[model samples]
Target: MSRRVRLALLTPALLGLGGLFAWAIAGLPEFGDYRGPYGYVLNQIVVPLRHSTNVVMGTTFDVRGLDTMGEEFILYAAVVGVTLLLRDESGAGRVERRTRRARSDTVRLLGVLMIGVGLLVGLWLVAFGYITPGGGFPGGVVLAGAIVVLYLVGSHRDYGPFRNEHALDPFEGLGAGGYVITGLAALALGLQFLTNLFGYGKAGTLLSAGSIGILNAASGIAVTVAMLLLFAEFLETYVVPLEPEDVGS
Candidate 1:
């Protein structure tokens, strides 16, 4: 329809959403209110139950894992939608073109160095997510950022492991699927879905939080692969003109 009509409709919708948000916010306890019931439960119930020192991680990947699963599926759906909508179906192969501006050797060397460091740090965060402040989400972002650095330095193609788009595609699915499988396995064992089914080890150690560690690693993999896939798609985008015969058909 007309732009004016669209704007009129959108204005009320925005206002309605804002009103609902404000109403919800108004119901929240005052800032710095430790006397709130939610805080007490978080400190006493959730943290001890998960055996996790990182309260945020415990809440996200364990206490509210079902909610997190919904969020993950939304992200997965968005990536799939983007891929389908932007699919290259013109049948013309990718056109090669040289960059107008070249990066300096120093930048390239730095990218190589950072890639190793990023990978190490990302894995460390995922592995230690149970005990530490950082988790899979941030670690995954770091890993993706490292790949982006490689792209900036024009070394994406030279990286053999991440070079193949098809190969990387499965990782997104695998990571997400692994998470669901873990939950389902718990269900099969008569435990609640996404429950901390495994034994909680020494509270402060790496292997302490049982399934939280697995979930964190899974989340890291999923986020890293999804981000990389999106980057590859946007980078290699090209337009193909339709042939006259095909257009007519």
Candidate 2:
């Protein structure tokens, strides 16, 4: 069978299955009562746990932390694969100095300022993720955006002094390890996996949500470092190729 034929058949089959499921659900109770134990749990426990309108976000970082760990690992693996595939070849010659573009000093200064502010805000978001609306993943992305802004404005030579890439692996490793340890601590206490071992604290305090806060912090650190490392590595491998012209040929 041709690929087109297979896809045509598959599409109809999926549509048929979807229709069947819809019909089956349509036949179920229309006016249900929330009185049972399961219903009570749903009302009291499950609903309260989801603090965000973003369903996937709430589930990944809050309700299903273990699963989120696996998801993070998947992302990490993808980054590693990209790094490997895009690495500079051994045969590639060293980069030589070249007449570089004249970067705008004003823009560079603004980028540095933005980087400083973004870093502080991102850190706050990560640290207070459990208490507030923001989270580690979002915070990490914010930091990455700051890095991009810095790169866009600064001279390529400026990145060399930063060594942001070198710091990433160790920091990420620490964050992952911290998350795992936090989980294990909960388990050791005879609580469920990734349980909120620490007090939820005051409803509005920075210390609210206990272990969840710690987990968010770990995740934030990991994601930030990983993204920065990946971006820097990508630039080195693909955009900044190891050609003599790249340096000074």
Candidate 3:
């Protein structure tokens, strides 16, 4: 059969399959209760995190830390795949680089100011994850994006002192490694895997919530930097010309 015919035939079958699956799932309980044996333990042990700013870390690191480790490996595999697929061709011919028109000094100054403010806000969110409505993922991503914006609008030559590739990669690796090691250490200390053997401090403080905050920070850094690096690689590949000549003469 022709490819068009195959797609046409498959489309309805796929739609029907999806409809049936959705129908089946629609019959499930809306939400599981916390009165069951497992829920009883989990609620006593874990529900506190639902109110946490670092909810991902609270659930993943303190409650399901081992699973988080596996998830990190999955992310590692994905990054590796991207790196392999998007390897830079150093030997590619030089492209012309048109000098980007300089912006007004006021515009440049405002961009720098925003970058600083954004970075500060992002760090505040990350640092206060244990006590507020913000968390590591949001904070780190905002910080990374703020820095990238600074790169785009404020400066071309230095890109606001960020290494972009070197520092972020190591930081992400360390974050992933720290999460895994923390879990393993907990296990070795005779606790269940990923158990929060450490004390959970008072609920509304910076130092409370045990390891969840740290895990949130780590995962946030990893995710943010990975995204930034991916964007940077894309810019280097399709947008930013390597050599000055590549731009129209």
- Please name the candidate that would achieve the greatest lDDT relative to the true structure: 1
Instruction: Pick the winner on TM-score between candidates 2 and 3.
Output: 3
Residues 1-249 of candidate 2: C-alpha lDDT, one tens digit per residue: 999999999999999999999999897766674345753544355325543333334455657889888867876787788778877678474453223433577776777899899988888777666555688888988977777666666656655533355556788787777888888888999988787677655545565555666778788877887787778776664334444544542
Q: Which has the greatest TM-score?
A: 1
TM-score of each: 0.80, 0.70, 0.73
Better of 1 and 2 by lDDT: 1
* lDDT over C-alpha atoms for residue 40 of model 1: 73
Arrange candidates, best lDDT first.
Answer: 1, 2, 3
Candidate lDDT values, in order: 0.78, 0.69, 0.67
Q: Which parts of model 3 are misplaced by more than 4 Å?
A: 1-7, 25-44, 47-56, 94-110, 160-164, 187-193, 239-249
Q: Is candidate 2 or candidate 3 better by lDDT?
A: 2
Q: Give the clashing pairs for model 1.
A: none
TM-score of candidate 1 relative to the true fold: 0.80
Query: How big is the positional error of residue 103 in model 1, measured in Å on the Cα after superposition?
Result: 4.6
Residue range with the least summed lDDT across 10 consecutive positions in model 3: 93-102
TM-score of 3: 0.73
Q: After superposition, which runs of candidate 2 have C-alpha atoms over 4 Å from their true positions?
A: 1-59, 89-102, 161-165, 239-249
Please give, for residues 69-139, the per-residue lDDT of candidate 3 as tens digits.
Answer: 77767776776777777776684633423335235888777877888999899888878865666776677
